[model samples]
Each structure stands twice: as structure tokens, then as C-alpha cells.
Target: MELPEVVSRSEWLVARKKFLAEEKEFTRRRDELNANRRRLPMVLVEQDYVFTGPDGPVRLLDVFEGRLQLVVYHFMFAPEWDAGCPNCTWLSDDIGRLDGLHEMQTTYAAVSRAPYEKIAAYKEQRGWTFPWYSSAGTSFNYDFHVTLDESVLPLEYNYRTKAEWEALPSGGLVQGEQPFDLHGMSCFLRTGDAVHHTYSTYGRGTDSLGFSGTVIDLTALGRQEPWELPAGRIPAPDHHADGCH
Candidate 1:
């Protein structure tokens, strides 16, 4: 019924110093990993993907919206689905209020496997204004490894698992393809109009809840009890986005 607190000033200092020294290794490794991720090889996206926007059909490159760099979050909002994926919902909640990302010369948008009508309905329900697109008509999902017939994620390589090893299900029982949704943000840079697919992935699906920025949710403020906004209080447009319509 109570949390024990008996550490003295000296004890606290020693413990804090120990924690800092131990955690420094982890911090250093993470920073190095991030640096390596930024340096990852850039490959030309040969596939010309098309997605439905608020108005009409648009090319994926158009999502850049003339910015030198583009960051796309493959949100989960497929037509057959009842709602967006929970993990994606977490990211979208953050994506909605980032107006300053544009100041960095980077444009961020979200795309879902769901069709335009479904996405629009969802957006209206959630009150989200970020440009949400539908990639139901193209191989964009597959190309990004987020739309597969089986949930076992693809595109893997390791000295232990061969050059092209397939990912297994979250649990042991593998069923349907859960094609990779490219969770988090994938960054791309355009050099002289010849766009280059640069850095990608903020989540990368590696750690479910490790990214500091991605974690630390404040529940006392946001109405998440029923996973919906307060009634009669201008609910988010996409929160009500349902595929049935």
C-alpha cells in the first residue's frame, strides 16, 4: 500500500552516480546506432507508387509537396479493417501536432492501406488534419514491406539467418500476412529534383516501446479511457473513421 523511501542523501548520490555510469554505455550505443542509421545506404525507389489524396490520385513523390525531404508514416487504416492499428494510433496522435517539423524543411504525411473513402471517414471521425492518403490501389504497401499476405514480416538479412531470412510472427502461431506497415517515419531527401530515398523509420518495429519520444504518454489529459474523444466536444475527425461506410 506504500512505496518505501529510506535512501539517505549520501546513498542517493552514490546510487545516482552508479546509474549514470551504467546507463552511459547504453546511451553511447544508442547514439552510435542512430548515427549509423542516418548513414544507412540510400537506394532509389524504382517503383512508382500512387495513392489517393483528399482530391484525387497522386504520386508518392507528390507527398513530398515540393519539400527537399519527405517523411511518410504508413498508418494502418485498411478498408477491410474496423479501425487503425493501435501502435499506429500512438504515432498518429503525435503526428497531428507537429507543425514545426515543416520548419526543418521536412514534410510528414501518413498513408494507410485503407481506401480513400474509408480514410476520409476515419479522418473526419478523429478530427485529424494531417494529409492522410490511401494506398489501396498500388503496391506501395508491399514495396514498403507493410502489406503482406502473411503477418510474418519480410525483408531480412543476417549472417545467422541467411541473406534473405523471413521474420516470424509475434507469437509462435503464424497466420496471415501482416505486411510491414513501415511504422514510424521514413525520411527521404530530394537532390536536384532527382529524389533520393534517404533515412527511414522512427519506430522500425524493433522496440515496441523504447523510443523516448514515442513513449511517455500523458493519459490524465487526453481522453483515452474509451479510446475516443469526449462527447459533443468536437471529436477528432478520424477517431470516428470506420470502414463500414
Candidate 2:
């Protein structure tokens, strides 16, 4: 791998300080964006979606656990599949403990199309403490646009249709395939007896949830993804070639 040019400590500090200013500006911009996100209009969720849990049937409101806010990770675990998606499992591993989020009046859980038995067994095997539920009998996944029907040719993902996913040189399965399930996160807000869909993000938008990626971004390699590298920066030989989009 190509290394950065050798520089004196004083020269390094000058470059670091300039980059630090840019980082601060980025942080400020992110804060503004977050505020705007919070201000986005919310739509009331009319569907009475029910999910199966380890205990018994759970209503959409119950999934909030009486919290003011709910964050559901749409895990890709089909009913017939023996296990959950490896990518979803990787994200689950980065979720860490949720007591802090709970303390702030937010509850986090994972929802999948798999049956309760399948979800329970997989959850136990992964040693995850966060709640997971099965939306097998409900249209929860479909309503959220995280699950596509087999007939839907060009699957919509990340808010766009990718008609050539399977035909691409990278050769990846499309979401339109059988056992259709996709990864995403949806946020809901509870007001009185009503729940409102606040926001949802799919694909690369959920990358911020992985703390490891944030740490990696601090290094010279910067995610080791071609798109993330600065212009003219020589990427590592083993950098990922496939783009997340």
C-alpha cells in the first residue's frame, strides 16, 4: 500500500489543524441536518401491524415498550431461511448495549419476516439482548418497503429502483428474488394512542450506526472504500471494489 509522504512534526501539525477545521465544519453541518430531519413531517401509521415475539403476539405500540420513540431495524431473515443475513448480523454486532437509548425514552428492536421460532433461535445463537420480532403474518415488511414481492422485477432500494443488480459485473442477488427481504431502519414516534412514522433510512444511510466504521474513518485508509478516498489518494491494494450503492 502507498504511504503518506514523510513530513516534519510541524508540517504534520499544520495539515492536521487545517483538516480539524474542516471536521468541525462538517460536525456543524451534520447538527443542522439532524435538526432538519427532526423537523420533517410525520405520517400517522394507520395499519395495526402485529408481530410475534418470544412471549406472545405484540402490537406495533407494544413494541415501543411504552417509550416515546421506537427504532426498528428491518432484519433480513426470511421464514424458510435457516439463518439471518450475514450483513444484518454484522450490523447487529455493532449495536452494543441499548440501556442508554432506553434511558432517553427510546426503544430499539429488530423486526423480520421470519417466524418467532426462527427469530428466537437465531437471536439466542447470536447472543443479542435487544428485542427481535417476527412479522410473518402481517404486512409490516411490505408496508415499510423492506420486502418486495417476487414479481416486482426492478426492486426499489435506497429509494431507487435497481433493475440491473443481478446483471452487474459484481453479480449480487437482487431484492426482487424469492425470499425477498432488505435491510433498513424505521423510526416511529408515539403520541397519545397514535403512532407516527418519523423517518426511515436504507442502504448506506445506516452506515453511521456502525461505530467501527466511524473509527476506521479516522485512519489514513478511511473505510478502504474507493468512493470515500480523497481525490488522488492512493488506496490500499485490498480496498473494496464494489460500491455500496
Candidate 3:
């Protein structure tokens, strides 16, 4: 692909210095937050869960295999749905392409409450090659607070930060209580054949990790504005719900 035009040497150097300083500060802040996150306490997982793989039933701990880290995408596929959530599809499309960077040193997989046969068929239909398995006959999905009888709204006070959530219904993903379907990157460390589920994040509802939205926001930023819909985009939640249609 053709690249954008480069700046003059002097201008490029100045820009580089500014960018490097900003990046260094961002890196420092990120490391500090991660340190705090790492120090957060973990809850006891009392349930012994198992999942269905191509081979057969595999214990939850066995999913990590030899990899030191395992990130599970709690895909939005429940027993009643004929298809996965479109938002999840949007995210998973990116994931399928990302699963194979040789140097990343991380393993990515997906677990859903749907049965293996059903889940496998869906993956095949989507032509997705990423690791996906079924959580049928297990409490793992529920334990992860991604599945249950009724929809969960994070019960604590929801903070609005991300653009999509802005002007969405005022009631937000409450910080501490919603047992909703969580989109998360779970990190793990493996030992022998047993792996420990190390860390996960819930509400404040995940912010942009700098691939798509954040960079776009930084350029044509609007989440800070009146939270209006983009010029050509669809109407906001409030407008639609208040009978604007």
C-alpha cells in the first residue's frame, strides 16, 4: 500500500520528539495501571468446569496447554440464539486475523455456552480458524458471569467514557454487579498441564486499546462533544427510544 506523504526533515524530527514524549508518558501510565490491575485480588473458582474440544471433554485448566497465557473471548453465542451477536462478530473478525503472529507469545481461544457440534458448525460457516469450543454441560460460562437466565445490567453505577456508551441509555454497565456477557482478554500462566486463570476485566466497560476506535477518536474526536450521532450515522438511543421514528 502506498504510504502517506512524509514531512520535511526538520518538521519530522520535531514531530518525532513530541510523539516520543507523549508515547513515553502513555506507556508509563499504562504500566502503572497494569501494575494495579495485577495486584487486584482474585476470587475463588469453586466450580470444576469442563469444555468439549475436538478430542473430547477437557477441563478448564487444560485449555491453556503449554502456552503461558490464554485469552478467552466470551463470544455471544447462547443456547437460544441461532447466531452470535453482530458486535461480537465485528470483534471476532479482527481476532481471526490476529491469532497467528509468531512472536506475540499468546494463545487466543473462545468459549461459548453452545454445544461443540453447534459451535463447530458456526465456526465452519464463518470460515473462522481460531480456536473455539463448547461450554455445554458446564457452569464455566455462568461462573464467568457471561451467561445466565436473565439479562444482567452491571448493577453498580456505570461510568460513561467510551463513545458508543455515550448517549446510549443513561443507565450504564454498572461497575460491580452485572453478570452480563463480558468481552475480555483473560491472561493465564501454565505449569505442567495445569493452567491457572490469572486475570480478567469487567465494567467501566472496556476502553479502546488503540487499534481502531481510540486513534479515530483522537483524530475526529466526538465522545467529548454533545454525544451527537455522526453526520451520516443513525440516530442516537435517546432519540430512537423517545419515538423520533
Candidate 4:
């Protein structure tokens, strides 16, 4: 790895202090943005979307497990695919357990279009303790804007329509094989047996939720994705890997 320029302890301290001030400002702004996010209006989920889990069929509210808030990661595992997306799996690796989230009155789970049997087997193989469900034979994925119909030209993703995606190629970031599912995250709130969709983010918006990426961001490498890093500070060619689809 290329090291940064060597500097005296005094010079390092000066730079660190300056950076700390900027960090504090960033933190404050982030907190304010979070407050605004919480204040966004929510839409009532009236559709009776049912998902299949290891325990059998379960409604959207049932996934909450009696919790007032629910966080669902829309895993990209199409019904015919043998496995889930590698990128989604990479994010899942950072999800250790649910005990902490549960204590905060939140329930978390991964939902996919794959069958329940496939989801169960994959979850066990990965040693995941959190609940995962199959939304196959339902419009849950489409309703949430995670999965798109192949017949619809120009895929809708990350809140962008197909035309917008095509305008900015970004090395085929939005282009890929047809009839495939995408990944996303959705948040919900339950009130007196009524469920409401509080928020949902797709594509890069969901990147910050993973612990592994946060750890990498703390380092000089900073994810090492092509889009990140300074022009001359890019990593060696061999270090690059095909990221999310």
C-alpha cells in the first residue's frame, strides 16, 4: 500500500485538529438530516402482502415480531437464481445478530423473491441468526420498487427511471441481464395493528448501513471502489473487484 507523506508530530497534530473541527460540523449536519428523515410523512401499507418463512406464511406485519418498528433488507435473490447476490451477501456478513436491534424496539429481517426453502437453506448455510422470508408469488417486491418486470424497458432503480439510468452509463452500473431482481432497504412502523411505510432507500443509499463499509471508510483506502478515492491515489489494479450488480 502507498503511504501518505511523512510529517513531524507537531505538523500531524495541527492537521488532525483542523480535520476534527470539520468532522464535528459534519456530525452536527448529519444529526439534523436524520431528524428531518424521521419527520418525513409515512404512507399506510394497505396491501395484504404475505411472505413465506421457515415457520410458514407470514404477513408483512408479522415479520415485525411484535416490534413497533421494522427494517427490511430487500435481498437480491431471484426465484430462479441458485444464490443471492454476492454484494448483498457481503452486507449480510456484517449483520451479526438481532439482540441489540431488538432491545431498541426494532425488528430486522431480509426479504427476497426466492422461495422459502431456498431462503431457509441459504440462511442456515451462512449461519445467519436473523429472520429471512420469501416474498414469492406476491407483489411485495414490485410494490416496494425493488424488483422490476422484464417487459418494462429501462429498469427503475435507486429512485431513477430507465431513461435517467441510460443517460448516465457509469460503466453499466444500471445495465445488466434482464428479468433480475435488485437490492434495497425499507423501514416500516406499526401502530395499533396498522402498518405504515416510513422510508425506503435503494442502490448506494443502502451502502452506509453495513459495518464493513464503515470500517473501510475509516481507513485511507475508503472502500477502494472506483468511484471513491483521489485520482492519483487509486489502488493497484489487482486490488479491484466487481462490486454490486
TM-score of each: 0.69, 0.84, 0.62, 0.89
Residue lDDT tens for model 1, 106-130 = 7878888887888888778877888
The regions of model 3 sitting more than 4 angstroms off are 1-24, 41-46, 96-105, 150-169, 172-182, 203-210, 221-245
**Candidate 4 vs. true structure, TM-score:** 0.89
The sequence of per-residue lDDT tens digits that candidate 3 reaches over residues 100-137 is 53246567788887778878888888888878878877
Q: Which structure is stronger by TM-score: 1 or 4?
A: 4
Query: In lDDT terms, which candidate is top?
Result: 4
- In TM-score terms, candidate 2 sits at 0.84
TM-score-wise, the better of 2 and 3 is 2
| 162 Cα displacement, candidate 2 (Å) | 5.4
Residue 202, candidate 3: C-alpha displacement in angstroms: 2.8
Error of 2 at 158 (Å): 2.0
Best by TM-score: 4
lDDT of 2 at 144: 82
- State the lDDT at 158 in candidate 3: 24
| lDDT head-to-head 1 vs 2, winner | 2
Output the better candidate (2/4) by TM-score: 4
TM-score ranking of the models: 4, 2, 1, 3
Q: List the candidate 2 regions with Cα displacement exceeding 4 Å.
A: 150-155, 162-176, 225-245
Candidates 2 and 3 compared: the better one by lDDT is: 2
